[model samples]
Target: MEQSHQALSSKSEAFIEKENKYGAHNYHPLPVVLEKGEGVYVWDVDGKKYYDFLSAYSAVNQGHCHPKIVGAMVKQAQTLTLTSRAFYNDQLGPYEEFVTEYFGFDKVLPMNTGAEAVETALKICRKWAYEVKGIPENQAQIIVCENNFHGRTTTIISFSNDENARKSFGPFTAGFIKIPYDDIEALENALKSTNNIAGFLVEPIQGEAGVYVPADGYLAKAKALCEQYNALFIADEVQTGIARTGKLLAVHHENVQPDILILGKAISGGVYPVSAVLANNAVMNVIKPGQHGSTFGGNPVAAAVAIAALEVVRDENLSQNAAYLGVVLRTGLNEIASRNPLITLVRGKGLLNAIVINCDEDSDLAWDICMKFSEYGLLAKPTHGNKIRLAPPLVITETQIHECLGIIERALNDFR
Candidate 1:
């Protein structure tokens, strides 16, 4: 068994070397080379299996290669794939209606990636501010939180506080106000001080910022403030939506409806790249034809895949499952933390959880721990150098979650 594992490791190393040589040096992925996945499990090229803890940064909420989503995509692909918005395709209208109704929005603007949806939302908000809210053109200001991880676009990164993502990408697009996360006072102050505020974009849980769950009532209070100021409250649920944070949308945890909602990642159950921005007619209708569009945004396959993905979220009750299993995961991790000194704190909401390592920001302890976890047949990644985010697929069962907990503890014990 050891020899076979060694051979598999060699094969994996060869694949990694090839990728390093051929592929862009942008992502420093785990050494494992995965070729297939099902549910919460992924198999490497050598057929070694491991639990998928990251879920592609919460993209695969329905689990890897969900059959329903894949079936829908396959059927749609076979039928009709792309018909640019120039002509009406059969699937686009039904999908628009279904998604709008599912999320309680009057309309939706579809896009291909989370960044594109975010950009769309930003453009819409600015336009609405000038056209509807009576703000001057090019003077619209959108408030964003520090340590935000929206996407890699220049306009999006202009306001990001992450030095790695911001440095050397200067001359960023302006018209953004940066505020501290979870600070209602800062939010209110910005609203009061600003005359041309268009919208306040925020993440309910701050997934990429190490799953930083804000204080209770923060979102509710912030939404109230946005309403008070007549500014749009935009929820970026790209990472925290679709049962990843124990709710269909994390904002639902506060029972507050955002004026503008940006959704992506798991909207198609990780089967395809599909994103959308939803708003009422007053806000979404600001854009005229030829103002904004994506050629492959509302294609037939994406529409079918997204509908099936959302249906699975409802039929399988993934949100409730995530709510229940999140408690289990956090409780198990807390128990383990009590016995492990290396773990300083465990924080997050639902399955979107992370552990703060008792080490410096430059320390590689978290990365080392993830490598050890991979060795033990589980997969996770580190963020901010000293934190590791553990978010598995919502389709995970209690038994599988408990098994993962055992593996996590064993890995921690080995490291300790």
Candidate 2:
């Protein structure tokens, strides 16, 4: 039996090998097998070390295997793992309090993933449209942006302008309007044209769509428009919040508070899956008992882990770190861009930044540069085709930033 178990383990590794060979070829990921991680670095299956720059789509803002978050997870698991909404657990209330107070919201609805939180926000907006705004039942509309990426869910992808994400995923969900991002006039025109609009859903900086940063005052202007039209301004900060973008939330950079805030990724410091929707009573109260929920949402383990994760963001001053390091990284990249025509632009706020490669979208240029980066001991992935997003863990130190910069410079030089 023991020999059979060993054979099964070998089969497991072979299974991973075979799956990659014959599985759905959706993602073109960098060829690196991660086995373990700590702080701002990950080791491959071969035990080679590399600095993690993408942070699992900014999910590891607290770095990998954060001790406090892991401790909370372990302790909570020992006590109780899950008690569905059929009954309450002790951890939910305190977690709700911590997250709401931290983000300056009246209440929070926890979920297991960023996409679920986004769907919850949509439901809340629709319900509020019916109950509060008196928009006829199913005619309510939500405004989304061009190149905005909410998630992979059917309804979320319905509004996506990216052909790849939306192509084979329909008959899509309806009742959404798409506008040019960072353009206030487009948003105003949509608002003026529609009366049944319930919300404006946006990413402060469109992360998956190549780390696109909107124009200055774009968020504030949109917020004002939403207020004037009595529509909810929903910010999908799953990638831009929790100090990934200098501020705790990127909307705060413009002094604009979203009515419905969706967060995930780093909520549990990347130790576990945790996501949430934050809003005041007027919007959140629309979701009553049995209206919306997840079996593992706000489970004791997730709640405890998320609480510790948020505390780490505060006690460690990760926001400040991101802000400072962002300046250093951006300035460094700008200097490099001055010498290399291959780099068209370096743009972002805080640590959420990207470099636009001046090459054909379908060419191997971006992928080649990524390989060069991997060789230099830093890991980053290209978005779309000609853009590479760089978002290291918020816990990265100045020395680490400089070291990573050296690696990036070397890779850029190789590209040249």
Candidate 3:
């Protein structure tokens, strides 16, 4: 029997109509609809090519549809996919060993999304506080920073300062102390002023808060303060880990090892959904069997994909490339900013960089600028209202980077 299929057109209007009619309206994505991607570039449904500057929010740090990562996933999908953690699969133990050793942690608890991994860390921190640190049950407090973007879950959003993410989503969870980001004094004071404090959760660089980088020595000092107060230092590297930040982990910039590390996004090179919580025995041991688990968390396919992804990070020397290219990117953008009055400031580390538009937060200038960028064959979007993050895949070449720089300059120049 022969199977037949309808040939789709390169025109984007009808496809966009289908999405608008049926898809959830949660995200206000750019008008362009991407249908294919390879390395640093993507093609729209209309067959227009553009540089992929966002990299799926750093999930595709290895690049779009990387052959090695996709190959590993295909092989594993053919072999074994899931066993539900009720019975261990062969790949689970090996992956646990590999990731733990790679990240210099004693153990790894696998999950399928960044939010789940964050929730896992939060649970571990609280349990360790109650059982190991001798805090009374139901009294553990975890400190979080303001303007943080951990995830969209109810409990995760409880401490979010973003009104849009939190509005009408609560009766929010309690026991989280909110303090300003990059403030060492505030963190130290919070630690000293509170008891039953389980952990201090932070992003090494606040990616969703418009790519806000902390002051020098802030992470190291904050970790020391957590040590002094016997609270866990939790680094949520969901968006900044896996060579996206010119290092395996952004916290490496400060030479600080977190008490518990939460990771996701590029863990499987964006080929599959995989996330993990890594910690030494003292913190991880608090979670007993039957207390915490997930159905597809440590599935064989996820294990294999993550292994190949981490291997790619190591084999490709992506961290070094990101470091070099980041400097080139920032320097290029800074020069462009000098000539163009619209781009106010450029900031970030590694490929995870952004340019601030010279406009008010409520203005449409940034969004309009992104539309201009799309027209100019470069794809990027505004983070808040006026800040646009430009993190391309780590595998992007130096030549392609400069080419994209030209596209950006043209976009800024042409924007009215």
Candidate 4:
């Protein structure tokens, strides 16, 4: 595989060496030295540009360094940066109004990252269960799917099935029941398993689990089951929201609204860390003052950036673009799959998609394939060992999409 690509430039080696010397060995990022990004492309320090297929794990749905989002952040930073929930700022009220209205929710609790939004949602659900749902204190349970990837926080990882994440994490948080993804029967059974069930926290489409889009009506049926059992259906749209999945949210495809809606990533157009959990007053009202918040959660910069980012999604019709281009991308992929035995399966929704390489989960074939992709001027990454997630920024045009597909095809041919 080393013969297939050029050696790392000295500048790249220096940056990598610095990180290895000073940074924690947490992430095994692809050996590339990216220094710049604009729209759908990112340039390495050595100036080799590549299509940004990963999109910062779908955080840059509005594309990289979007003028509107960056402009909003910069404009807000210059005017006002931080006024915590202790003191209200001009940006927070408008952001609350706009976000609640945009997502058709009664209220929103803003946060700074996807995991924080998820953690916020869990706290809200548990609080609501105890306060409103009449669940016994300290006994409320939330159901999660197997092979889920909500985040890396201690509480979040407690329910995760991935052993590597759970190893040495110790004394996992209790009160979470695990079930299979896309299984309505498993959901009903779990809901029936406990009267103290607080909610069912789920990813509308399990992105980190290799873009595992569920069956049609799985979300709607799950919501109905939640209603049947009086458990809140919390949809973690942190990765699947903001037009990455062809709809405003993946749940929109099924016309099901989550009791607690968690959003992050593209909410700030990848320029700032912004996340939020939205729910109606009845559920959100459980929290009193000083109950939960972050110092920078509702900062002016996040609010301004999120407003602009969401507006860009609406004005640019990112949802429509994703829906149309999804068909194009998938059709091209299926054609490639038909001719290539190496690619075993293609499945996903909208811009969030993946191709399963014909290898075991422990195999490094997908990682090596991704390395070849990087060498060919296209950037992508492997998840769960054998799946190459192919989500580019929603701002990517059709010509760019075709160009990326060509790169992928040529790169796969090299493997052949």
Each model's backbone clash number: 0, 0, 0, 0
Q: Candidate order by TM-score, highest to lowest?
A: 4, 1, 3, 2
- Write candidate 3's Cα lDDT for 343-399 as tens digits: 999999999999999999888888888887888788898998889999999999999
Segments in model 4 whose C-alpha atoms lie over 4 Å from true places = 1-5
Segments in model 1 whose C-alpha atoms lie over 4 Å from true places: 1-8
Quote each prediction's TM-score: 0.97, 0.95, 0.97, 0.99
Q: Which stretches of candidate 2 lie over 4 Å from their true place?
A: 1-16, 21-24
Candidate 4 colliding pairs: none
lDDT tens digits, residue span 211-239, model 4: 99888989999999999999999999998
Candidate 1 similarity to native, TM-score: 0.97
Q: After best superposition, candidate 1 residue 238: deviation in angstroms?
A: 0.4
Q: Clashes in candidate 1: how many?
A: 0
How well is each residue in 65-149 modelled by candidate 1, as lDDT tens digits?
9999999999989989998999999988899999999999999999999999999999999999999999987899999999998
Could you tell me the lDDT of residue 343 within candidate 3? 90
Local distance difference test, per candidate? 0.92, 0.91, 0.92, 0.93
Query: How large an RMSD does model 3 have?
Result: 5.4
